[model samples]
Target: MAASALISPAIHAVRSASAIVCKEVIDSHVLRIDGYSRLKHMMHGKYIRSGDFHAGGHAWRLLYYPNGSQLQFQDHIAVYLQLASRDPNDEQVLARPRFSLLDQLGNPALPHDCGMHRFSY
Candidate 1:
């Protein structure tokens, strides 16, 4: 029969709804990497990170290891895409990522498209 006890239950009764949406590209940005071997991206310190880029109102990065991710395949290259940050209120984000490796004259030697994937923080 106390005022403080009555308020405690109501404070915990909060809910939120989740929904999905899509965005279209009105324009595009092409980042040309010539002499890619000479480009060195290094994290300055333990807390520092490299290769930060922006796309679709979000921060993203591409990590590349020329010597492969593991010891087994040192001859090959390892690449990955990482989402740097996300809004807490947002539960899911739809993404369609495309990647290409070009030759010296800017022709696509290898192209990859990881069609429509869901990303959540």
Candidate 2:
């Protein structure tokens, strides 16, 4: 089996001048799994991570699980966004991460997409 996914990051920034203002920066990356069936059998709870990608001045990666992260949900697949960059002060990084399964034609599989989750790291 083979699978593909799109991971999009939406970063929210707040700027304070005479008045406070907010902005958003959106970026995305595609992750392709060539041998998903083999991975599912070989890697259970463990995950395959994507190479470092950048968004909103921070480095990020996608954690793909062939099976679920936990035993109870083993029948399902899971994906997570991880912060790959390290800050000297260990400041938290905030982002809204969206995960979508791609169709055979490389478009998003509607209704099969995961909702955006607020992530802080």
In terms of TM-score, which candidate is strongest?
Answer: 2
- Which residue segments of model 2 deviate by more than 4 Å? 1-17, 110-121
- In model 2, the worst 10-residue window by lDDT is 111-120
Per-candidate TM equals 0.56, 0.73
Q: lDDT tens digits, residues 6-121, model 2?
A: 88988989887696676778787889899888898999789989999998788899898889899999988888889888866657766767677789998877434344444446
RMSD of 2: 22.7
Please, what are the lDDT tens digits per residue for candidate 1 over residues 14-36?
69999898658532234554444
| C-alpha lDDT of residue 36 in model 2 | 84
TM-score of 2: 0.73
After TM-score superposition, the amount by which residue 80's alpha carbon in candidate 2 deviates from its true location, in angstroms, is 0.9
